[model samples]
Target: MTYQNYSLKQLQQIDAAHYLHPFTDHKELRDIGSRMITRAEGPFIYDSEGTELLDGMAGLWCVNVGYGRTELAEAAYEQMKELPYYNSFFKCSTPTPVLLSKKLAELAPKNINQVFYGSSGSESNDTALRLVRHYWAIEGKPEKNRIISRKMAYHGSTVAGTSLGGMDGMHQQLGGAVPNIVHVMMPYAYELALPGESDHDFGLRAAKSVEDAILEAGAENVAAFIGEPIMGAGGVKIPPASYWPEVQRICRKYDVLLMLDEVITGYGRTGEWFAAQTFGIEADTITTAKALTSGYQPLSALLVGDRIAATLVDKGGEFYHGYTYSGHPVACAVALKNLEIIEREGLVERVKTDTGPYFAQMLKRISGHGLVGEVRSVGLMGAIEIVKDKATKERFSPVGSAAVAIRDHAIANGMMMRATGDSMILSPPLIWTRATIDMAGDRILKALDLAERDLRNA
Candidate 1:
């Protein structure tokens, strides 16, 4: 029986009874009920009640090519009919994965030419962690396995990914985390910068924290430092211009491998194939997913640099790590088609030259609102910091509550944005045009005004 036969109430009841959603509070969800998204097209999603919402978060930071992409659907259908379920195990190979690998290699940075497949960013990050440690062990340094990450930086939700990540809330839920993963200060100058500190100076200082960790742990004990190029789930925290170059220098100085988790920033999100290229980072490994298939299918690729790939090739030995759907043919096919659409439509270039700059300028119109402390963006990803006092930059009493109010207001006003603590974030589809940007800006400003009024009354 398809869900289309059921009423919205019936569907909600069924979902509450059987479905356990990720990162959700079940009891709270049951109280509120789910807003059933029946369908989506372009950059908007429609509820079962037929309310249209301009998706500002791109369906949880994916869906780059927008919705209703028949090309992706057709590609998946064709691949499924031809070779639906084949495992890349026991010396078996598929044409789609092989072709996708070549395409990804051509698109990725020059150093990253090899790929390891997984179903999601979390799984690929697990692969990256294991692969880097395995590389160090094979090179006759078994003890060099500690990884340094940034506090509040999100990697994923798996045990290793959560441990590599530095979210205190996630760590609290985790009974215990993987050992030897240390976290340092992030390069978020808005909150962390000292009074009168320059962005460049703060960036260097943040990079220095990585060096300090290596020194404290002994460089020989540190294998790699993994981080998101732009901390997406951690409030779209884009580092300063000087951050990545300094971090790269530090990693090179201590012979530490630089791992980039580009789950949210990959594809056309950053006006480039990968955030590593957007930021000029020379990463040893890049864990990518999300927009790889524009959320049409689940697929992840861990792009390995030449050095690591060469080491694995030269010092050949089974690393003993893989998933059942490592290189799923259908997912790869959808991804290939998604990449084609991104390229065919010139979405990346559009984001780079036309929409990105316009979006930033549009966001500035709302920056002067009393409730917005700061507005920051890179490419299509953006953040608006909610503040209680404009001059003092004081946040609301409960940290995230203000952003929730604003997000609710935004959704009520027919736009979808995300709330991370006190920051309202946006990662709209690459297909959004100047008109879409204007609409979003107006909706956001209205939401901000509503939030400010409500907060003042409260």
Candidate 2:
């Protein structure tokens, strides 16, 4: 009776009058209207107008198991009916979160054996910042509280998350960031690699920046070095293969804790349970959310390593930080069922063996396009860089305009995607088949052709 009773126009009118969206321009949005997504199933979403588009961004880089999972819904319903809401505080506990935490610990890296719950990636990152600092303080190094992040990294949007991240726009609007969180260069070989530099060499150089930051901070002051394993919101900037191991080695050398922000890359997104496993990274903390329950529920788990967990337990002081919904029973029930669904369907195995490789091969269809500067992909996530000059990899003036045009054209052609800077990003659901890949590629090629014509005309 909700959307059924309200007309699309009426909903849009009400939305414009009352709603506020994140990372949106309100004035510009008021000029237009919100595109109401009425329903979704498999890998497609239907708008209020009944136009269906293949979802290529996986509902903001979550929804790993895709949409319309009845098992997850039923799990939530059963949990709610049995135990609607309860706080994991005051010496109380819940069975669902307790069981979910054990499942997560089994899935996480061996050293990361404990779980801390929150409601979103932002909250988990906040917890991560607090946890690492707390760990150092417990170990009697309160001054070792500095965090090293990468430029263009997307941690989350909370004040602590924003400060831990290194986006220029977010920082400008942030007014001020948390202190001692230094930013280093990202290991993006496409732009950062020098002429005649091998990918392996470029990776080492990028990893060296962490060492430099540690040395500058005297190692005694730096607490942890945080980064997304695949840099998802940073245009899926996949680093060179040699980057992570070397960063891990440097962190070990400097005793700087490694924090992996896998909010977008966790829960089989990168063809593994976690991208830390994908790259053999031994991070002290892994911040995960988004696809944890395939977007069926809001939940985040900060996987803490043994070293930190043991110290905190031995210190025996209350952490003095936790959310009211830290371990909500309903969300935990949904997540357990969601993980079961992922495992039962062998979705991760499919991505690792079949779909992921096919996606890499299929993306070649647009690799040679006139407007495409370079194409890159890992697993199901991909990026197509739009450029004015192919030889020089020079982008068009008014940055992001061409990619935005391509994105719009792609959506109009029934292929949903996102544009970040001058690159078109695609992180489709894990359940996509070869046929879905072909369909998405065809629509994107059409979009590229249309955008090329418009750009050349201008």
Candidate 3:
């Protein structure tokens, strides 16, 4: 565990020899040295080469408590000393999980009364799939089993979650996705809009796609429709105002459960505690993770509403679905502390009243930029779509590479960000300030300028 004796070159060689990274091309990664970060503190990371980089993506859109919170660490240590691990299965229970569930119920969307624990966002969503199917089975309508998701939405990487997620690349790699899962067009007005299409009309048209899909699939066989409120990792596409309301009405018209995947948008990222609240959508089930522990520990939760819980309890005797580490005490302890920090610091309120507005205003400045087509944001989550032509909104011919170059340029300028397709995305730590925002905005623009110059030269 001692890293002091090793040089950076030695570490890189060891990594190349032994490590297999996730969501990476192993052969290409071995050819290029991976930047090994040794430590992180307060939104800044120090790599093995001792270079500091400001983390603008908030460590994969988690780490909302920022980095290096000793309180969270101490909380985990304390819980471990008392009890390292325990399962929620077989009537076994722990205080931490029980307490965390209560807290989540109090904090999550209204009418949601029960919590099911998992180890990651993926597992939580996978749990959602099972619960919906189970609930439908309990209702004596096992035929109602199809699920609908939005195109380009990112849920998680597990079989069911990935199938529910609408990334075509991920789906194609996995081959035939989990049967009964379908996707509708994302309400991306800027990209999918017809010539002279108004935002309102476009939103209604987009929202109706769900109803159309349900009817196509036969509503009697459709169980649930899942989507992220702000569609994170799908180029940070924020839907139009008319979208969620119409979507809600459609879900109700059929007896389909409306599940909101709040994995990224939960815990103050969306200014509201959950994106469902922000968008005024009534969700029968909600999946949350990431900032649940602020990346201090691996934990996730699936909050079940009263109707679903009642069905499960009334018809089911023994529940067969749960992870071995579903309610790990240490993870629960860390999550408790993370929630406490957010509450005590008033981070969510600050995001709602001050930081969210400041961030949005700063983002809006890019709206008039020639290379930028749109600057969309809600609370701390945002994206700037890079366009080749302003009026026509023409994207780069080579596609996603230009955005990747902008991301690299940002990193070179000592900032961390993620870009997808032609969109440069930002999801700063919830503890971010006006000063940090100003610096990050400048750094982002600098990267865009470099990308623009490179495109011109090419």
Candidate 4:
């Protein structure tokens, strides 16, 4: 119960020497040391020194019900006491996972009824890739293994997830990536739109790229198209209104399966149970994690559509892919409780009707800031573009410097935000009320104002 035997500085030293953080530059982290987040509560996190911050990223876009929920903690405790650890293998079964699967089926689109579990979103995506490929092979079309993803689109960091993604820097390190995966232009109208293209037209053109990829690969060679409803880590890039429907039409035209990566947007973050429902699209597989347990436990459930499930069952063979912690009992228990909390508190409906709109309106009030080129949001996820010249939408000399500056200032002013490239992104907890939004707006304005002075002077 006592972890403070080492001082804060000592803890930092130990961390630098031993802990290798994900997606971190170790040398830089060693030099700066990590900011020790010691505790959290509803919509706020506190550092080791007890400085409170409005949690803007929702603990990496999870923690939807907010932090410090005793019910989730109690659920984990009870499940562990009952059935601590049991592998969902060898025809073994667990009550929590089975019940959780039923609940997920109810929440998911009508066609999606089955669930496959993993500990993280990355693992879920890997399972999805293998399973889809397996589906075609069972259907007697082994050559239909190619996948279509978008440039700057983030799936996950696992080998298959990365290969299926289109981040250039990630690919530079990813030697001998999973072959047959192709990337197309994302539906990001701010940059990819033509000189004077309408948002709807740009969306159509973006969807066309996927069709072109399918055509180039000859449809028969393509397996599925994977995408986030609204791009998350790649700067909360919300596609145009016309994008998903057009993309779905194209995918159906070619008979290509649709895979939705809802790792960030799942579990009511998009004001719906799934972003697919929010976007009015149906996916063959929905890769979900994150908010399932509100970060209280690590769990992911790949919602499998009936069509895919039917094929796997009718074809009759072991899928030959899964994780040791698949359908983990404790995680499933926590997730069931987490979902119950969201439903009982009406968090999803609140996001859809109240706070989501209020948050968007409040964001607009700060859009007049000189550093802001544009502000956009969907549900609780949003982004603020940091531009050197608002009229031209030009970024600072160094790509991420301005956004990082603003991020640092935001943190200093009691708000936690992430700087992705030239934009500051926010995915706050669903529990945030109008007061929380107003408080966040104040901190954001302060951060922008402070960063603007520093950027101009430099």
lDDT of 2 by residue, 166-235 (tens): 8999999999998889999999988899999999999999999999999998999999999999988889
Clashing pairs in 3: none
Name the lDDT of candidate 1.
0.95
**Quality of model 4 by C-alpha lDDT:** 0.94
Tell me each candidate's RMSD, in Å, in order: 0.7, 0.8, 1.0, 0.8
Report residue 124 deviation for candidate 4 (angstroms).
0.6
TM-score, structure 2 vs. true: 0.99
Candidate 2: lDDT of 230?
Answer: 90
lDDT of 3 by residue, 80-165 (tens): 89999878777889999999989998998779989999999999999999889988887889899999998998889998888999
Candidate 1 stretches with Cα past 4 Å from truth are none
TM-score of each: 0.99, 0.99, 0.98, 0.99
lDDT by residue (tens digit), candidate 4, 1-458: 35567678988998988898999999999988899999999999998888999999999999999999999989999988999999999999999999999999999999999999999999999999999999999999999999999999888899988998889999999877899999999888887788989999999999999999999989999999999999999999999999999999999999999999999999998889999999999999999999999999999999999999999998799989988999999999999999999999999999999999999998899899999989999999999988999888888988999999999999999999999999899999999999999999999999999999999998
Candidate order by decreasing lDDT: 1, 4, 2, 3
Cα lDDT listed for each candidate: 0.95, 0.93, 0.90, 0.94
